[model samples]
Target: MIEVRDLTKRYGAERAVDRISFTVAPGEVLGFLGPNGAGKSTTMKVITGYLPPTEGTVLVDGLDVRRDALEIRRRIGYLPEHTPLYPDMPVSEYLAFVAAMRGIDASARASRTEAVVTRCGLADVLPKRIETLSKGYRQRVGLAQALIHDPEILVLDEPTTGLDPNQIVEIRELIRAIGREKTVILSTHILPEVQASCDRVLIIHRGRIVADGTPDDLQSRFSGLRRLSFGVRGPADRVAEVLSARTDLRIADVSDLDGETLFQLESDADTDARPLLFRLAVEEGWELTELHRDRANLEDVFRSLTSA
Candidate 1:
């Protein structure tokens, strides 16, 4: 539903977004990840028609963002990092005003306002002024304003920035539910938020996109090697002797606790040891208590991609 090709944005001599490219399909939620000053917000601004790219093109549902800004705006709901709100307006009144700005007719304003208020859980705050609401309620009001038009695509930047744990969970669940039928591009520094809410992720660094894939795929690609841990009830020397026969696996660490021995193995070679380990334990009369493989996670991937 969205495509960006070699998009670049510059301020004076510095390039904020350096020729980055990616795509988002319908019903897909893509997480945009980067550290501070990594051009995440710059890219979002270019895509949402808030700023024009210095080079390349951004397309929403096949409409060029630069050439068809109005049409693209009609289809996209943008919630910037700093949500612009009328502090003096009541929640319902503020949403109604935004709906009207989005071109809702006078007759349909009330229903449209009600729908977004319900969806964003702002019903309780309807009568309260935005300035009087809590941080969570204020965030909800921001989201309600964004969805007042029911846009096909949602571009949310740090949608849960200042909320409590409960409010964060609520917003995450709400975004996940909305993503079931629409395209979403979510930008955040919170890695776990991506794992919990996004179907895929794009990692940006130094003004360019460095990695793009599902979280599991990026983890596997960066892990490169596998590590395994095992615990057995046996003499440490005997356990070492038994494992020493397998030249394919590298014995990384070994320790003993009471009568039980723990083995840590690292191998670049792809070897399945379930059958061999089980049979060897049985033949040696050792009680094999635990065996497991450890793989890289999103944190590892992020560090590998972003570190200089």
Candidate 2:
């Protein structure tokens, strides 16, 4: 559980994060999305106690991030965009070092290290130095260190960066698996990753939250325009006349191809033109071959929100 209230972060006079507020419930995976220089990483740093807020407050499980920085860090496992790691240390040795640094008891260190090693698929690379591992494995080592202490919250920034498609899928599944138990705030620009692994999305632009919701919720909310595409067997003039009579529907394009008339209709905002079109076709005795509505996807929503 995490809460951010009117949080703002500044460097000198430049406000990297401005008055944004949101909450992440337990077991939820929140995707933090933004273009470059949008302050996503700044917000995460404030939440994880790596950086202090210029204004507002952040609370983790009811503890204030400013006053309880150490306590909050104990509950949070953070993997920054540029993961800090000891490249010279072996995977197992690195994990053990992190566990000890997190104040894990001497007795629990061995088991905890092994648990994270297996959880993050680091077993095969345990004896190898971190520098010798592949990009994907290096990322796994970063995640393993983050989870070595078994924190309640995981703050991951670009956890899948630089990995190939297969490795990206593996990391996405791992993050999804972790989200089953702990609250996760995943910061990345990849819209599909958010769609595939995150439960909800928060889009930040110019230091402010531009959009917030589930993938479908956002698609519905910001999908101001809707397109209806259909094909019918009928007189093109009569079809155009019938559709033209409806002021709510804007006929974008109409064409006749291979004796079939195709129509593309646009509405200023989301509207059910299907019912009216269907009724008109039925009344005109037109044979409807196909009908469908095109809705916006997550990327469309992102561009619409973050674009200039």
Candidate 3:
């Protein structure tokens, strides 16, 4: 539903986004992740027609963003990091105003406003002025306006920022539900948020995409080596000797703890050494107690990609 081709954004001599290309399919929720100044927001701005790219092109549902800015905006519901809202307007009144701006007819404004109010959980705060609402309610109001027009795509930046845990979870659930029908590009630095709500992840760094794939895929790609940990009750020297004789396993660490020998094994390939280890222990009269493989997670992958 969205395609960005070799997109770049520059300010004076510095490039905020450099030759980045990616596509989002319909009904896909893409998590855009990056450290501060990694160009995540800059990319989103270009995609939503808020900022024009210095080079390359962006297409939304086959329409060029530059030439069809108005049409693209009509199909996109965007909640920027700093949500633009009329502080003095009541929640319902604000949504109605947004509906008008989106070109919704007067006859359909009330029902549209009510639908967004219900979807974003703004019923109790309908009569309250935006300025009088809490941060969570204010966020709800921002989301309500974004959805009041019922657009086909949603570009949300930091949608859960400043909300309490409960409010964050509520907003996450709402976004997940919305993703069931519309294409969503969620820009945030929260790793767990992506794991909890996004289908795929794009990690940007230094104005370029450093990683792109499902969270599990990226984890596997950059996980480097696998580590096998085991605890066996035996003579530490004898156990070490047997493990060292194997050409497949590279012993990373070995220590004697209590009455057992703990071994940390490493291998470049994704080989399962547990079965071999059990067989060796039985033949050597060693009592095997604990055996497991330690796999890399999303956080590990993120740190490896972004770390200097």
In model 3, the runs with Cα more than 4 Å from the true position are: 225-296
Global Cα RMSD, each model: 4.3, 4.6, 4.9
- The candidate maximizing lDDT is 2
**Cα-based TM-score, every candidate:** 0.81, 0.81, 0.80
Tens digit per residue, CA lDDT, model 1, 74-100: 898899996667899988777777787
Please identify which of the two predictions, 1 or 3, would achieve the higher lDDT against the true structure: 3
Return the TM-score for candidate 1, rounded to 2 decimals. Answer: 0.81
Model 2: which residue pairs collide?
Answer: none
Can you write out model 2's per-residue Cα lDDT over 163-251, one digit (the tens) per residue?
A: 89999999999999999998899999988888888899999999999998997788878866677887899888888888888888878
Better of 2 and 3 by TM-score: 2
Model 2, which residues run further than 4 Å from truth? Answer: 225-296
